[model samples]
Target chain A: MATRAPKTKRGTARRETLLRSAERVIGEKGFAAASIADITRDCGAALGTFYIYFTSKEDVFRELVGMMGSLTRRMMTEAVQDAPNRLEAERLGLRAFLAFVAERPSLYRIVEEARFVDPDAYRAYFTGFASAYATHLEKAVAKGDIRPGDAEVRAWALMGMAKSLGDRFVMAAEKPDLDRVTDEAFAMIRDGLAPGGAA
Target chain B: MATRAPKTKRGTARRETLLRSAERVIGEKGFAAASIADITRDCGAALGTFYIYFTSKEDVFRELVGMMGSLTRRMMTEAVQDAPNRLEAERLGLRAFLAFVAERPSLYRIVEEARFVDPDAYRAYFTGFASAYATHLEKAVAKGDIRPGDAEVRAWALMGMAKSLGDRFVMAAEKPDLDRVTDEAFAMIRDGLAPGGAA
Candidate 1:
């Protein structure tokens, strides 16, 4: 976590700017090469001012990773809220995730980098996501919105599919045909959730 | 590539030792924290002799990533060679991948670290794997063993699923249950490959 949260609206904006700068600097140069001075320089703040918000570079990085985790979950929930069934939610959620990656490439890079820089945060990010996702899968199964299967296994598999698709189509591709990617993935996911699917 | 492939049999053994040593050092300490001297020390090779085989640490690291990519493909192909059909191959492949990860955790770490240390090598590794996987998917579709679909898209999606499962079940879990993970993942893939599937 950050050392402290800003007490005023202006301070909040300043802190936010520093975070945005960290994303750009760290994402581009990577965690090893990125430094607090570089982050402050990019944000047009005095280097000493960084110590006012973040205790260290590691602190800001953990905060960034944590922030991304919350943002991802919230965005996904909002994206699927209008779906009438779990199958539809799967489609909407995959689409939302791909779109989110397109809009925020740094989020993908940061989470990945966290794997090396901050191991605990990295594990927490995915484990937390998989836990919630598994619960959702179990509920869908009980509601008959999907086939009965190993919720934990399916959650991890489904999440893996989305993460890989995002890496390929969104992060790597020049003109990401997200529609096609989602449709193909959704087709496979939808079948796996069908009643006759070997639950 | 290494600085040079040893022509003499004894020299070849020495080079292989250094390469293995590098994997241990890099995998344990990570790319940034790991030094070339530490790698040589592990292999009991003279620090200066390290350069006789590899120009630099980065060169050796890239070679290692490339080696892992080939080894992974070769191992997976061998694992599925006897499958009666595509469905059986999916089961065998996932099982093989998870088992390989459990046995060689370094492979997972190296490929992942390649993302930051050697981005191009990282891209090529997965891209190459996906291309070969897509070809296999296309052949299966043509043989009527699986439903027709976008082979490339499905290849990446399925690869992602296996990769994630490997990370969670094999890399992270204390004692991974490879059999159950394969069974659950295969069930989903089989259903998703059925004729009625969207393909």
Candidate 2:
């Protein structure tokens, strides 16, 4: 299922261009309706150019899911790099997530579409994210930045919150207030796990 | 697009069969790839019989989403019917949601597919749920069963957590512990909004 990675600089650019085309075409038209020709035409590349880099439409779609995972992780990392603690990181990270959704709504759609188009890729995307996110939470707890709890459950729960908020506030809203939504959602995240929570 | 509700007892049964077939076909192959013939063939009915109930494939798909929405709401209502308080209801509701996902993975897939296949239906599903869910939270806040917070945000956030948990712990799990997952998740939901959370 691995697409042939480009070797030369020009080849690398061609592959990236094709992947971008797939994201737009597949994301908009969906995996079943979107065709390789539509992706190639959008890429400004000949039909045969697609074959040189990827084996099939499914191949390119899988690559797109994988690429989206990497891109989202990089974006989240860069967005929260300077946070003083995990709690603050949670705030910055959520704001970053919502803002990213605003900027790359298609990426969000692509990852979701991967659930049907490529279930393995979809599972890997969230599972991998949850795994790493849980580790981050574990360390935060060890350092007393956050309260002790099951990081695995918290990781998935927090990811779910961000995703739902993005869908409701950003993807679905006409003009969403990113800061306000983040503040409201982060309020729950902070106090939800804060030590000595009242009954 | 609306499917014609059955007028007679036999018509109703036939329509139900078609809807079941549509769920199986569309959930497996997706909306674009799934055809009327595929649904009818799966239903063991002639192709022409499909139009007797559903206007088209799109009609039946829309009906399936509606049906799933009703079914989920019913399940959740039944699950939380006897809860002593909102806190207990939250625990029961989350567990019920995870169990529903496990029982009917196809329903989850169909609803998600609706997001792209029928944007209006997708919006209606979440928007309607969030609207009702917000009301529920508002009542709980008024009763002092939970801390005061933005009902709209909590509704979406809690829904997100349930959805994400269902995906990770039920739909994708090789073997999942419904009780343990529910307890861990309910813990966060409980403490996150608990009054007087420590800074």
Highest DockQ model number: 2
Error of 1 at B41 (Å): 1.7
How close to the true structure is residue A100 of candidate 2, measured as C-alpha lDDT?
86
Give the per-residue lDDT of model 1 (tens digit) for B83-134.
9988788889889999888888876798999999999999999999999999
Q: What is the DockQ of candidate 1?
A: 0.48
* Full-model lDDT, candidate 1: 0.87
Report the C-alpha lDDT of model 2 over A31-74, residue by residue, as the tens digit.
87899999999978999999989999999888878888898899
Candidate 2, pairs of clashing residues: A192-B192
lDDT of 2 by residue, B1-199 (tens): 5567778999999988988989989988888789999999997999999999989888888888988899989999999999988878889989999999888888898998898889899889989888988898788878877776788998999999999998888877899999989988887777652223442
**What lDDT tens digits, residue by residue, belong to model 1 across residues A127-184?**
9999998998888878877766788988899889998999999999989999999998
